[model samples]
Target chain A: MVDWIAAFSMPLIQNMFIVAAIACVLCGVVGTLVVVKRMVFVTGGIAHTTFGGVGMAYYLMSVFAVSWFTPMIGAAVFAVVSAVIMALPAVSRRMREDSVIGVLWSVGMALGVIFMSLMDRSVVTPRSFESILFGDILLVGNTELKIIAVVTIISLIVIATLFRDLQALTFDETHAKLSGINVTVMNVILYVIIAMTCVVALNVVGIVMVIALITIPAAMSNMFTESLKEMMIVSVILSLIMAFFGLIISIGVDIPPGATVSVTMGVLFVVAIVVKTAFGKITQGKME
Target chain B: MIPIEIKDLSAGYDGRAVFSNVNLELRDRDFLAVIGPNGGGKTTLFKVILGLINPMSGTVKVFGEEPVVSARKIGYVPQNENLDSEYPISAREVVLMGMRSKKGIRPFYSKEDKEAAERAMEYAEVIDFADSRISKLSGGQRQRVYLARALAPEPKILMLDEPTASLDPSMKDCTYDILRKLNKDGVAIMLITHDMSSISHDVKRVACMNHRLIVNDAPEITQEMIALGFHCVPELVHIGSCDCGGHNHG
Candidate 1:
């Protein structure tokens, strides 16, 4: 019912697809690790906490005229810093992990709200608020695409090089420690890549929806996978499918692409859970 | 050199020591069982020997070197933790994971690693489930997989933390048989257990710790060791006699 060729003809749509593919690969890989490590809450904390960096970047750019300080760079720095802080022995020893995360999550968003509010009216764009909070994937240019591509390439390389170590660490920490793998170093690497992927994911799904995009597809794939590698592969494919369809549906309905993608993924996740449960029950009945 | 040597060792958290004046040794092909109450510094001793925690005083050595310096010569299995049933790793994959170290960033496992994993799986009697999902296997099968993971590294000594805590009698015997076989193959074995019920027939040396070490060189667990190490020993309702009040020997 839609003009498919006409949609593909648009440079904006093409660019959106490119960025979504790269970002999804990044998200899918990191999200799989986060899920396996039972650290979805950690990634959620990283994504939301990085918003403080975004607000800080805006503050510097607007008031101090620091043109070189981009919001993406700020997000990356903040994410890594937040992850390292959480990994610190002192912080973990003194406070409950969830408590630290909850505090950071709230304070970061609040800071972003205040910073944006204090910005000059002239500096504020018509779509900045909506786009930054929820994504405007269509607005991503070559520069944004290039940055995400580089990040994805580098992250994938690091993940590949350390895949075995990461597997051991995630599979069993005590065993990994006994086997001579530095558990601390592996945790640092996993968190660093997770934070960086979250920074790139922000451009596609924004701060509020970044967690869902990174988590849902991988989680959905996780339901059907028999291995970590299989989970990531399927997760990346599912993410691509979801992103493309969500974009089409959003364009058709004039809704936000980020919200559309999130809703679509959420619906699929519920359906997958239902089917998995039903299948399991059926098999159990047969065996009995 | 002795596989593990601890002399007058004391370890704890903060500035205060939890247990002190400890002396122990793990010799070649030794099957030693360390038993005590929970929170009686059993895990602390394991940590100290694994170089995870520094001893407050005295010394601990592995192969005549510091614990950290010779850590690679030992394979360790902690208390059974349920790996996420949803995690989709195979038994063989789990075995292969043990071949990794912090030495270098190698992306793929070599053929030698695969062969070593296969051999370990065979040794642990888990080759039957090597291709199966780890979570799909039974408890005994899963335990073997974990054992295979420990064996994959081919260490000179094996340290286990309550390995039979959750297993049934038959499975426990099977695990003990495997440990005995591994011991015969020239690997020193050190096991930590909270109860004597799980201690197998082949465990010859015993150590108990409440606030201090009580090493029993003989084959039996003496009443004095139980009285000092455990707070309240369990009474056996099945038989007329209590378990910890007399000598435990087969």
Candidate 2:
């Protein structure tokens, strides 16, 4: 335990812990809306689709030899664009939602692969792709931590200010509209928030694992809570616990932190579902 | 004063009209029931009046202005299919949504907002399940909660689209009775539904729309109006012993 305390003193572990806490809290709040709004597939699409921007940033950095260029900017831009593209068809009622999402999902990945292959071979490397897919949480830098913190604050402020409008919009959009809430504008803002969240959480969990972080904990919370407030509270708590446990286990077993974090949350999610189902059955039997 | 008025309104999707050449006027003390066949542009008319969709041509005024401008004075209950039952909200919380328009910059609900929500819940007879999960409630209970949500804003006019679609007979009767009481309290109501039996006695006026608007002060439904409303008038059913057919002397 003394060694464990000392180990946490290292800046790298400390950064990992800080990022985990921030990401969990952010996911907890945002995830509740995502699940309740049924934006799981859309969010997943945004996450995967951001790779297009990642590939663009990589190709540009190599071509221009600009050390200042980073994938973070690329991810932000691509995420927003992808979200808008995905949201347009659904909002307009012109196309079926699933088909549009499916198309964007594959097109995004394909565009990323194309951009990567088009890059200069000498600059492109296999290790770079691995870092994007499976994040190296042990290497989280101060810059990344700052970015996450800023995003977390922004997310909190926006969600807090729009809490009432969001509640109405999510529950009954027609009523919200009649109540003078701008449904279209609010929807765009929500998608943008989701995009920014995806970009901020990308470094902590990587593109593949970020959706799980946002969705699983919220879904777990939904199994028990009755109100959106309670769901958010419980989800945030669950995210922090999962993140802490995953971080500790990664340190102990010498495994990749990102994969372990997602796996830990996933296993716990399954366990929660089973327990809730069993408990529900027993209670229902008694009532009958 | 007229709370809702539409003149020569033509609205639809993809530039194709769902309703055309429509006209209507709703008075403050009016309890109007809009009944027609499925896909007869009933919901579209409500959307136009609610400012969800723009009219292709013609003018619409809600409370003597653009519908969006006076939206705060209007309470709307959409089809229950539009409200997801799986949402994580309590019955009271659902009602509190009515106060959202009034909560401009305040992050939290005020004492007055809470009081209004409580009163609305009480009026809707859903105070007992104020804390219960909305999804766990039965169909009738959920309907009551939604009605309370609409009433929480204290709107001058209430517009409901098919509030009794899936309810049992007794539940349907209960819902109609509540609407009648609200109407008696001088709240203007615009109800769009297919079940003419339950609402014919409660409403003061009747309208039928199938791309065109037909309004009548009496509860009687004429065969000419039915022919124009349903495009064929296959068979007319009498509602409330008021012969709904063969009244050509309009």
Candidate 3:
């Protein structure tokens, strides 16, 4: 037992824990906004569209020998830009929002596949695609953990400073606009924040399950709290617990941490819904 | 002084004109009721005044400034349109939003703001439900709460779209009583409704609209005018005698 614990205490495992904790915090905070604003679909759209950025980064990496951060930066930029474009008045007017998201999703997948086909034949490996799909938690080095820490801290500060504005905007957009809150600007800022969260969380939850990480905990928290601030705190705690449990389970069973985290969150969500309903029925029965 | 003035205003949606070349003026303390048919442009006119949509070619001013620039002096009550009642918001919080529009980024409501909101709630008779969740209120009660929210801003002009649309007879009377009192308190009221007969007794002026300003007259709707303006013969319509009991219309 002591030998196993020592083996798990390596720098790689420590780095993974730190990076996962930061990603969980960031997703929990921003996920509350996404749930309240009914932007789960938009977050899904950005998540899928990030593949285009990955493709762009891969194509440029061979030519310029850029670092690993280049892909994440490209993904963040594309996600934010695509989100803003979809939200533009003209695009929203010309096409239904869901249809626009569908178009972007297909285009992004196509671009990613084409770029993969064009990659150097010798470098073609199953693990490279696996990293994009399921993520490689073992790759979270100290530098990656530091980057995640900085992003998580900045996100926390920004959300705290604009808490009131975000609350007002989420509850009622017209009222927020009338209050001179610049609803458009605030919405853009929120999209940018969500985009950054998507990029950061992609490393932990992977691209396919990013929205699940961003939505499940928040949805679970909503069943218990009415206040937005309280919901956010509860969601953050729940996500952190899930992340820790996922890491432990993955270490014990040799399963992927992302899959473990998502499955745990799903089970928690179902359990929360059942408990809430049972409690509600019990209270009503007692009142009667 | 006139708080709102529209001249040669033509507005529409999707390139199809709803109304054209409509001219109107709204003076201070004036309660003007815009009565029109289903496809008429009553709501469109209000949207235009609120600067939500632009007229194809015309000019509109609120308090001698463009309606968009002078939004501070105007409070709007949209029709009892379908709102997601499941949204967790209290009635007091809804009214507080009115004050927020006027006092942006103040961090806290002033004493004067609270007093004004309380007074508005009293006027709308929604004080009892101030702490209640908005979703729990009935249609009439919710309308009153919305009115209180509009009045919280203490605007010189208040515009409502079909405030009595879905109410029963008793609820309609109660709503009109509140509106009449608000009008008496010198808050200019602009109501858009299809229930012309219901509001004819309370408002002094009625503007009949179709694709244009058909008529902007005092509460003197005659059977002949209804026939001409609506292009339909009345079915057992009763034209009442005026308040002075001297001018009766048939």
Highest-scoring model, DockQ: 2
> Each candidate's TM vs. the true structure?
0.93, 0.91, 0.87
User: How large is the i-RMS for each model, in angstroms?
Assistant: 2.2, 1.6, 2.6
True contacts kept of each: 0.80, 0.80, 0.18
Rate residue B76 of model 2 by lDDT.
80
Candidate 3 B-chain TM-score: 0.87
Candidate 2 regions with alpha-carbon error over 4 angstroms: A1-9, A88-93, A120-127, B103-105, B229-250
Q: Residues A1-288, candidate 3, lDDT per residue (tens digit)?
A: 235577477877887888888898889889988987888988988887887787767766654455463567667767888788776768876788899888877887677777666655454232376777667777766666777788778888888887767777787675566566777778877887888888788888777889888999988887786466777889889999988888788877878888888898998899999999999899879968
Error of 2 at B215 (Å): 2.3
Candidate 3 TM-score, true structure as reference: 0.87
User: Candidates' lDDT values, in order?
Assistant: 0.81, 0.82, 0.77
RMSD of each: 4.9, 5.9, 6.2
lDDT of 1 by residue, A259-286 (tens): 9988988888899999999998998899
* Clash totals in order: 0, 0, 0
lDDT of 2 by residue, B23-141 (tens): 89999878888978777899988888888788999999988899778767787877776679989998888888888766664578888999999999888877877888878887777
User: Sorted on TM-score, highest at the top, how do the candidates line up?
Assistant: 1, 2, 3
Kindly give the stretch of ten consecutive residues in candidate 2 chain B with the minimal lDDT sum: B241-250
